[model samples]
Target: MTAGLRALRRRILTPALSSTSLEVRGFRKKNPTAQELLETVGRSFLEGYGRIVEAPDSQAAEPRLEAIPREFRGFAYEGAAMACSIMDALPGSGGRRLSGLLAGRGGAHTYMAYVGIGWAMARLPRMLHPDTEDTDPLLRWLILDGYGFHQAYFHTDRYVRGQHRERKLPWPEDQASYAHRAVDQGIGRALWFVGGTDVDAVLALVDAFPPARRGDLFSGVGLAATYAGGAGADELLRLREGVGAYRPQLLQGSAFAAEAREHAGLTVPHTHLATEVLCGMKPHEAAGVCREQRPGASDRVDMPAYETWRQGIAGALVSEGRS
Candidate 1:
């Protein structure tokens, strides 16, 4: 357990540490030592992801969302834990300010973006090592929640029916063009969430995704928005376009083989729930909106929720200066 915790601290929390403040001359900043920063980031990251918000008791619910499974509700609260964790783990240079900044909409953007990156990296590994339990339950949840259990695609479909059957499936060639753009947008969402206002890095990363393309970039943003819950009318509109474009062409038989159908079913309703939140509805209100759109949609509730949780935890690490 200690080794696992140390690995997570070094690997995950190191990136968010404040390098800018480390070079300052003279008497040193408050709690800005490397060890201090490491501790802060590690604690924050763990606490953020570790927190599992239970369902709220009656009368304390937010106005816009509807009732949902315990896991699906309190995304903002979860986001907060993540942000707090991130702030706690990071160096103190801008620690408190960074922590507060993450509480705003910009923080939400960061949480979702990191979730996307983490999800993309972990997908195939889960298939290859089905026996090894993944450390980030939230990341696992988000991945399965968003994409579903299309393991056959990795194990069989791409090798059999996909465009690049000669090589590995979900390879850079197969999904990177689309997924890369989404990644860029996901980064932008993080910037926005943190209130940084700059998006050059986000766009640059998107451009860097293996099969870069302009149209793909635009679509990626829409897809990211859809995954993050759209936030407003315009975002939702973009999401619709992206989803429509990505649907048959991007997914189809390649990602979803025979047994994978149930997993594929998870996308739409969760998108609906995300859209509700992105459109400014509260968690329960968003859930209501989702239900209104698709009656009996409860079955899709827990498809893969841990991705969001993982993101929340990661963000918390950044905020806490632990990551």
Candidate 2:
């Protein structure tokens, strides 16, 4: 990459540039590959994630995740939103970039790539219709997600031909497969987060699938709800109690992950405190521990640990993307 492009990549990775600073990368049809974008996402929020949260409206593309509660940042929902926010900053060529990425073999490998696109699509309605306030945000989110999924799978941007209502899901599901059915299920999951905590739609979507396929679908639902801060400690506990025994740690871990990321972004000491709390330490004790260990700005933070915490939770959620 040219030095200019490298600098641009760094800038894009961190979140929420002031609206004034946007377009400085010089928008072109420069649709960087999925590999490039995947790399770029790493830095987007590393430096300024907390600042973005501190004053989200100052950014060019307002991150939808900022509107949600902070408890779910560890959830893939925030990942998706971050991905979407990144894509929104680019031009139409982003569709091509996303399509190329999706062409690869499916599995845990491509899960994050798909998430970036899903996040972008989720924000499209608001981006496209800035003044319109739809009564049903969940339904709106589903439409955007489905449309983007169709475009990615079918490799076309012109949805107007039929708006992808007639896409196929002929691929049979198995333990290793992520058929077109997974896309539909994921869209259903995004709905629960963008909408209220109402799970009626989520349960219905889960019922539509075999018990085997429900895990992948519900993973999205749980992650989205938690990551988007739609669920609190009480609600998370209730959700865990109600769901299959396979998912409690993940839901809780996602919340903790969000907390960790937030604290890390705000100040490194908070990161330690958050980790201690997640490891079953009392909040008061964790806070005291972190207070004593807090380091100066001259010292580098253990950002790797923070990233590891995020990846650990998100990776598990994506791995559940079975057929």
Model 2 agreement with the true structure over 1-323: per-residue lDDT tens digits: 45566456546554443321213321111123322322232234232233222222223223433343333222223343334344435565232222222232211112232344344444455344211131122122232333333342233223212223334432122311223334544443433422234444345434554555445455455544433333344444545545564353334333333333443232233233332323233333333333333333231123323223333544443343410
lDDT minimum window of 10 residues, candidate 2: 130-139
Best by TM-score: 2
Off by over 4 Å in 2: 1-114, 119-176, 179-185, 199-201, 245-323
Instruction: Write down the worst ten-residue block by lDDT for model 1.
Output: 250-259
Please list the C-alpha lDDT of all candidates, in the order they appear: 0.29, 0.35
Which residue pairs show backbone clashes in model 2? 13-43, 13-44, 14-43, 14-44, 14-45, 15-44, 72-226, 72-227, 84-120
Candidate 1 lDDT, tens digit per residue, 1-323?
35456445445533232321223211122233332432332333323333211112111222211222222323333333333334333444232322342344324333332332243333334333221132233222222212211121122223112212122323234333233333333333322222111123223333333343323333333333343231345434433344333322111111111111112122344354433332333233333322232222121233323222222322332233211
Local error of candidate 1 at residue 160 (angstroms):
36
TM per candidate? 0.27, 0.35
> Model 2, 196: alpha-carbon shift in Å?
1.7
